[model samples]
Target chain A: MAGEVKFGILSCANIARTLISAMKLLPEVKIHAIASRSLDKVQSFAAANDVPKETKLYGSYEELLDDDEVDALYVPLPTGLHVEWVLKAAAKKKHILIEKPPAHTVKELDVMLEALQKNGLQYMDGTMWMHHPRTHKMEAVLHDSSTIGRICEVHSTFNYSAEVAYRRKGGLSADVRGNPNLDGLGALGDIGWYCVRGILWAYDYEMPKSVTAHPGASYNEKGVIVSCGATFVWEDGRTATFTTSFNTGHVMKLLVVGVNGSLENDDFVLPARADRAGFKVVSNTSWKDVLGGWNRTEDVQEVTLEIPQEAHMVREFARLVASIRDGSGAVEPRWAEISRKTQVLLDAVKESIENGLKTIDV
Target chain B: MAGEVKFGILSCANIARTLISAMKLLPEVKIHAIASRSLDKVQSFAAANDVPKETKLYGSYEELLDDDEVDALYVPLPTGLHVEWVLKAAAKKKHILIEKPPAHTVKELDVMLEALQKNGLQYMDGTMWMHHPRTHKMEAVLHDSSTIGRICEVHSTFNYSAEVAYRRKGGLSADVRGNPNLDGLGALGDIGWYCVRGILWAYDYEMPKSVTAHPGASYNEKGVIVSCGATFVWEDGRTATFTTSFNTGHVMKLLVVGVNGSLENDDFVLPARADRAGFKVVSNTSWKDVLGGWNRTEDVQEVTLEIPQEAHMVREFARLVASIRDGSGAVEPRWAEISRKTQVLLDAVKESIENGLKTIDV
Candidate 1:
């Protein structure tokens, strides 16, 4: 129980490299093994990433899951494969740190969550920004009534252009994210997940009454969403909107406006800097006497991190896993709940987009 | 024609004070007269604002229009009065500098523009931000394909909390902007004008194909909109969204994302400082090799102004008037065209909100 938590990664995804790097920075966590369907890819990935010598390599995922040394699993597989591998990992009694857009739908996520819950496993999504100290600092300001008051509106966007590469690879049909057989949700699942999660996080995970996908959603030849936007309306008249795309320049922005103030961050999904991050907060904003200018300027509040946000995620996930393994604590339901809420909203947005952009009740 | 262009005030509204102050700063412009429906109000406003001793005082707007020495009129009256006064001013052959939300509808604006065109008078709106040097600099970035590339998306918001004051004044019924018989359009016309104009300006005045008002638009008891949002879709897949309110804290933000880059300005409507304004631009954005951070940081580009934006606006207006009166130029139609386009979109958003949040074709 006092030893480090062992993590076995289930794929050779580009994102897995980031997780492995983060694990290397945490003293309480260790990358115990890695696997891919092809032995050559696993060996090359391990070598390229400088995986520890003691870490085992498996050509098949089943072999890694059978290794009792791996107390927890980091599943960075395609969203379409999450349900299959996550259920298998849960049956092996492994705590999970899964990639986002956790599954193709909330139903799939729920089935996987039930298995983990029954096995008493710690479960958390791979939204690293949520683990950043800057996030918690911003939350403190949002929670303080005098600082931001009641949130009235929110807008978030996460976009990056992937069209150039997709075209070079003989169009979107060859892209993993654009292939319905591999990642069916396309841009909505791969990137829009961050925007939806950001809106839910800003609202403290309260589900919206209705979700309406903005019109003109772009789709690939295979009918996978390439770009989309949606609006969320709550029962109390509060509202939020988000946009995600694989056809625009990289942009990650989150703006939350309250009755008394507002807060904004340009890098809500990933910090532009690794050691420190900041957000702008302006409270009690008022005009200079004759409206020539604002009475107060936006204040930039920065939080310094000893390590990167992904490292923080690894440390937090390991701490939870350690507690559960030592019988010192029960499984934390908050993480799964957050992931479920995000997936539910993502599903609602997809439904609205598919149903002629109709308003879908959550 | 060699003398300074003389200006007459059409109302003693609060905003006229700022215009008067701006006129005082420009050597080519002179405040020749002040007028209001009430003599006492006009006299008090002139005294309070330190009007020149030679400036004439009129008890009625009709008298100000009849003044032979006044070359132009600055109309800052309520939105409902624009069509009437603007047409009257045009008939008198006076150059006009009108406040924004040019008219209640595009049809009314067209009628006013027609009158102005027939009279051969220069027509310009009082959107001071457009005249700022910073605006031109940002435009340069937008026009350069390498900097921001083809504009893909835009999000603008201009909100100010007037709820506390409105509640104190008998629940919005007694408020000027909330009064259906006066401003009529409420927050949408009053503050949303800036957001609509901002979006139009960012898109270089291209009209969108359709507009859909987001749900949960709040309205007063008299059916005046207090808060609202809308999404705009262009034929080429470029899109924009905007939100305006009298129920949230002060916020003026314009974010434009392009295929290769993005630009954002927090104080787009009114700069945070009078002497300087700035915007953040980031081009060719990409993640670092291992996704630890961004490869480049957003650059803050600032432009210093020799005078306030309002002063620059007055100076520009006077220049155009001087050119027209001297037989050196004709009325510039660009200003009127921009105003008309913004009004058309604003009308569409209002229509969408009124008709059950339907998507209205532009």
Candidate 2:
């Protein structure tokens, strides 16, 4: 426990509550501090969530960063604020775990990543599903040429209907995600981030040659994208597509098709159950003789987990933090690299949407 | 049985063999004749498929069409030949069940359809899944607002890897689907027809305002498209996308997302089993409190069938033919209209692909 990574949560955002609960399962991770612009809000959040009595509560993010006991920070601020707080956290030598759509653009993210690298601080975007055991199993199948052959296409979707209260407000200006000033990327940055990441992960992070936005993207009154989709094409004829929205029913699906097989998971971002996650794989698929039906149906594969995916994410992040703290490893660049590629594609999609849905060179 | 519709088979194509087998289950249908360019080939096919001893065998399509006993024609000729044979069949007053991508172009299909309409002949394309009981069940869910409200997006894919012998021929020109002179549209016309039809079916035959082909369409040496995708956008902001290929594993997936729910089926085109077909639906989908996992997972709904979908298709066609022959009904316009809309979209996709992936007005 001496090398425990103490996490100072920078906001009382709803997502932070989930992270706090996940951290509870890891001894290597400690909820060292909670901070908010409002001291009363931080106090209520901590007391309501049963935060340890000894854990520090800060009225401002600066106070938490200045706390010598806090070794890392979980910045769940609006995307617009990531660069500012992340740069400040790196300056303070705090390892950072930030929310996704890591920045408004790849250039913005590169600045923060550079600062984190210079400070020898660990950095990872909070894409919890990346750490799930099921994800690893799916990857194993994807990598096996005999199982999937050469990757041909990938399709991912992440969508959810906004609450009635949010939609009834007319402009949804009150919600950070729908407010252009707070999260300009809107649904694309919030939920679409997961879809873009899922597609990239299936392709093993190979950068697509071009990105084209599908037409008819829905936008809020403030010109923030509420729903949109885009297609990605690789130089080798492999293609991928993703759709994201805050104006549709919840759906998190990822499908990867290859020359000989396919893999699909409906709850790729978050499983239907915390105790286990499942995906369906169909290998060497063909029609039955005489074309009556399929010769073989997809097999549903499940991976049971001792802890939820979010907890696994916390444990993994903490393990990296601990290694860096003990001088046993340099900062892991894989997470930062993945986040950068996702952000790059996210920016390309936005660019394509803005420019008459023309295909953008990635 | 006195008014049984006698169907004349055109060519000994592999698909015709399946149709002949399906027709065996329909007492209202009788195989009156089998035809091919070669009399020996037709004789071999009739023998191999166990055609009834009384059925006629013809050395040419014209000879079969001339047989007065044949009330309808099952035309499984390559797409390039549809216009010629379909027009000839209409002139002969034979009801027609032609294979999909009914013609290479909508103009050609329009000519054939006009001739059929003027001749008072029943016309239907060979899209077997449309006749499946499971398709009706899935449609009921899609139409129910409470189950899946306000459809927003649809995605369909129909892909199958070419046989090794076809690919080993260096250009796949040996296969009709891969030969520009025979089926120039190639995958887009063959498998892609199902995807376009599936999308149109999901949208209730509503015509899209625009169609845009995705980049990276693969082609054989003869300039026939072997793989491609396209996006369709409606006037009401509903969007649909489809991918089809002869260079990937078998995949028949359809996903429809609405404001309140979603429906998905992996085997949308062909069921994995002949006796039962299934689709999954998730209503009012939402994340669990605290964003842990899905509140409710998709429920797989299966519809048991008394006969295979192909048999269902054959029976339905036969019923229509019987009705027309018995003076109980005139030619049904619904089937022709559905086929027309699908062909229009299919042509638009090809035009878009040929025109630098431009967005084409539907």
Give the DockQ (2 decimals) of all models: 0.65, 0.67
**Tens digits of lDDT, candidate 2, B268-298:** 8888888888898987576676636877556
Candidates' lDDT values, in order? 0.88, 0.88
Q: Per candidate, chain B TM-score? A: 0.96, 0.97
Stretches of candidate 2 exceeding 4 Å from the true structure = A164-172, B164-171
lDDT score, candidate 2, position B206: 91
DockQ, structure candidate 2:
0.67
Report residue A284 deviation for candidate 2 (angstroms). Answer: 2.4
Candidate 1 docks at the CAPRI level of medium
Q: Which pairs clash in model 1?
A: none
Clashing pairs in 2: none
Candidate 1: stretches off by over 4 Å: A164-173, B164-173
Instruction: Output the lDDT of residue B167, model 1.
Output: 66
